[model samples]
Target: MTSLTPNTVAADAEGLTLIISGDGIGASSMLQWRGVDYPIDWIVDVDGDGGSLGSAIPASALAIDGTFETVLVTVSTGGAASNPLPVTIFGPGVGAAESAVAGAGGTVTASTGRLTATYTRAAGGYGTLTAVDYAFPTDPLLPPNPISPVAFVDLQLLDGVAGDTLVGTFLPPNPILPPNPVLPPNPVLPPSPIRLAYWTGTTWAPVSGSGAVAPTFSFDWATSSASSATVTFDMTSTPQITALGGTVIAFVSAFAFEGFSAPADSDINVAKAGRAVPLGWRILDLGGNPILNLSSSSVDVSSVRIVCESLSGEAEPLDAYAPGSSGLQNLGDGYYQWNWATEKSWAGTCRLVRFDFGDRNPDGSPIYRTAAFQFTR
Candidate 1:
């Protein structure tokens, strides 16, 4: 069970902190806010079962300031997602309870045309960068699903403390569309803005109270920087910084993600045991052209584990046959199938097979594609 504290906020609220309390929340649990996923900072784990997750919502509702929207939030961990909670961002307000942050306000820089952008920290609280690694980002169609980002920028900060401050000006990516000096004005919709995010080995995620995965690192983000042509973000050092493997590579808020659609739950349960069942999963991107790698070559068949949940409510993983090497077939189009060597001992028990294609939500939540079977033996 999971719940949010003070689940209501002012429509124009800034610097609001939300607390999530739940049982069985894994240390790696992440929060799904609106269409974006956030990392949860655990305050305490009561006997490793329940605790309050932390997150900072500088702007209420959606990331954009002044946007009035009722946000549905959830926390996911231990292969399970908590129930949805609606945190209403209330009122059409003119209240200014929040004050501006006067940090080391730094300098001006620019981002050019490229997918991977880089920033170098200067002496003062300023830095400069240029980037634009164009990616066709998408949102995962899995539990606690989030929306896709229209345009994303792959940003990397160089130099330790000073550089990460992100206190500087940013110019638009270069090669700007040639202006039709002769043409008249045309009403055009703008692409969705990308949020400040980091790589989680699976997907791009926003930096929040939650910790970073894979590299096992952390960074201080000034959630107030508006993604405008000229933007300045105030950042500082945190106690969670790790020197090695801690190089922070930030990406725009996530969207257009990988969706696991294969090995439907209905296709798993059976009336018998000891049968070779086809248990596997399929991964898909928004468009055929994905920003992340989703292919057979990327998965290691040797890491497959068959977990058993006995009638006594006990669950553990066994070193089962590798799904790809034994009776497994590459079905193409991200479909990898494997024959389950069901054991007679599994009678009257539930069997689980999990596959982590290294795909995660923008909030750093791994999309664990799993298959399960029930034995009536």
Candidate 2:
């Protein structure tokens, strides 16, 4: 719908086309909005009799300005007779913004924009055509209906222009919800029914929607003196799938650390270390599939680093590495991500496959980092 309000004066000048269909040999009638009638326009095959009113006018020409409201058309089936079906015709002036027309097998051409409308009376006296707005439904921060089935929830943040900052805490139902006076002086916005959480720099806030009721949210912030801190929220616990948009990983400090070397010396005293046997080296031929399982039997290593080369042409690597006896690491886990980055530059060719691994031995010993796997496209 246009942003203009009702009662706004509209204009019209151009003519309009009204198409009407006939059944058998019948006389069709035309009527004006309040009740004026006109002879149904007819077509004649010069060779045939002008008997009874032939087929209804294939197309009728009418002078219509945008402001014209309604007109009417009626079909008269004679002799072996049928009821006079009244067809309502609307011009742009009626404010009928959308309409549909039967195309093939009872289907319709979707309605769009301001235009003329023609409704055909069906066999059962029902109007086969209906009109509705063409605009798409919006996803607002709040919802008219409210219900919470699960303890955890996802809230949407209000979208804003670049450089805009959401400084205060957002209230439930409305972003302008009153704050809990008992807590420190925190500016708050009302809550929304759509419970998607958003970040307002220092903390997370819920986006509000229509009919959303006010609810309390616990706030938590994680930070460390190290260059970066890894927060582990279970994938099954939260709804996020990819590491992008609205979410972030923060690095508190910036420092360059020394790069370690691959293992070189083969022999060592009994107390120093055990022999390093080459672990299983294999190709990750299947790209784009989930990493279902990873199995390996090795002689000596504190940690193992795996890299999917760009050739893997896969989506982001699934977090599949295990740290010590922690079992399987959750996908998107940073332990495997950080270690692999330190071990190798892993990027696969666009349409090719690749793989590599590193044995990160403990006690500052030289760990053996393997070569990247090469493969055909």
Candidate 3:
């Protein structure tokens, strides 16, 4: 017995065609078409009907007796019958004319009395199809159901820091349905749910909050409207911000069905309390480890610099220290020491010193002042 691949059936005014395929069928193989045990016709491989895989059997030849919604078609070889496949038979006047049907996320095409639909399933493979019979103006035109995808229009950073709230505005897609004419028309649609995550120097971290609320970000749709929405990321609730080095915060907005949008960063610098204190006369990495300076022959010095300013009285500028500068010397293991003696005026007074090492985080944000050291000589 040969196994057959199921055939797709398409019907028209002329007749029906069973597009069939199978394995292990030779010239002597017998092919039979049947509907409910009523023998329709039999074709031998040597006959022209059975020579090709797709054999077209006319409706008249099948002798379809009466009205039937579905016809079961099967193939048989060596007296062994394959499983029957059902073909949907449209009623007389239905689907007669070329119809254009549009459904959620997809479209349908009907041409020359054949109906075919190209549809994309929504998330989780679920979708709805709405079909209507086309019979001139008598049939009311389907109300316009526009589907607008959710999107962020204006993203700005109102504030960014460990303690302050990160704020921004986004626009959700417009509603598709029409307003109710009887009851009070609700013009503004509710904002879709969203999650806020900021780019840590290393990876994306969710903006989590402390207190009774687990996640700290707040969806402030009340402050928004149909044209736009607002959200706040509470940095104080997220303890991870304390370890972050820079004031620049890059964050992203995400929707369950829409996925993530490109990252929108805060341009304004947010003040971070208790930034790492720079080591007096020393340079350190972001992790608070002293960065030792190696010998000039072994180290590339172009990227390193130190800025010192007197915090007491009027701010006095001290000559910036660099690798080749007389007072700047490299220790070992990425550590460096600045000799205050070179700047005689800067040695005796209280001063604020900042280190600028050519180091960057994985997210491309510059590793700003590892520590701000206040030195009193």
Candidate 4:
């Protein structure tokens, strides 16, 4: 004897259906997820119940709420039957209706935002199918789970419809500020006692260095004569010097004396001899090799200071070669002497002196001098 089994089954967002191909003699039954019997009425042309199938088993018998559920078809027949299989029923968030229609089965299920309809059949011939519609949830609600201020709000109703759109607006974070302001200028070097450039609002003009001073456009001279004249000129920010219109010349001349070398005085005889001349003098000639002169012409020694060294390596306090003490007072005029009597030395050692000059060329460059000698007993 042949058994009765479900040969076809179908489901949509609205409801589920099962078709059992009947054989010679057998009965078909519907099962639910709980393995319990679910009421089902046979579809027929004539009325069996009070009036129709609706009267025998209410539509609620096959209808599922907005919750996950499943149903199956079971057949009891001649020889043997397969195990009862279950087909899950998902909540119709997008399309749901009160009752099944003649064409679609039951009320349509509703859709949330961007949701697709999925229908499945199990233990039956029909396969699972999926359908998408632009229609989605209309009322947007915050995501079931959220993190920060930003969240995905699902729009209901409209989610299942085609060509539907979801739109929303939110404020962003604030802007950032700009950087700090700039500072002004402050002067350090003295304005005078030093040759300076002209003030040009922003910076000093006629800045001089590297072998030359700033440029001069004109020489405004208030001179008595070419030989003994004082020439004045305007030095611009540039270097090349020129006369305004006419040609003018001011000659600078000096006198010199050439002679033999000066005798080196004994360091011990400094007291009795009263003064001892320097190793070299400011002279035109000394033993043929020019003397280590001090002037704007050659050895331009500006300020001289004396430090005495002893044989024991101890040193004395530094003494300036001022006007009355040493002959260095007339730096440019004549020769001078450094005597041990006036500029005393420490007990065990002789004198070791070092000289320094301000701006080797009277134009700001460093110059240095050093000498050593032994005082007799």
Most accurate candidate by lDDT:
1
Tell me the lDDT of model 1 at 19: 78
Prediction-by-prediction clash tally:
19, 38, 12, 37
Tens digit of per-residue lDDT, candidate 2, span 95-144:
22322223122322223231112322222322223222111121132122
Please give, for residues 160-200, the per-residue lDDT of candidate 3 as tens digits: 23343322233222232222345332221112223333334
For model 1, residues 1-377, the per-residue Cα lDDT tens digits are 44566655665556667777778665588777765667778655634666556776666443433222345567878657776655545344211111111113433233333232223334543222322233223212111223333233333332335234342223222212223445332111113223344445455444432122111112112231223332233342221222111222233322343433333335344435565555555543322222333444444332232444333332223223333225446676555566656666777666555554443333435445555555656
- C-alpha lDDT of residue 164 in model 1: 44
Off by over 4 Å in 1: 1-144, 147-264, 288-297, 300-328, 361-366
Please identify model 2 stretches exceeding 4 Å from their true place.
1-17, 25-34, 42-72, 79-96, 99-110, 113-377
Error of 1 at 285 (Å): 1.5
> Which stretches of model 3 miss by more than 4 angstroms?
1-12, 30-32, 36-51, 61-68, 92-377
Question: Which is better, 1 or 2, measured by lDDT?
Answer: 1
Range of the 10 consecutive residues with the lowest summed lDDT in candidate 3: 256-265
- Kindly state the number of residue pairs that clash in model 2: 38
TM-score of each: 0.30, 0.20, 0.22, 0.20
**lDDT, each prediction:** 0.40, 0.24, 0.30, 0.26
> How many angstroms is residue 134 displaced in model 4 relative to the true structure, after the best TM-score fit?
9.9
Q: Is candidate 2 or candidate 3 better by TM-score?
A: 3
Better of 2 and 4 by lDDT: 4
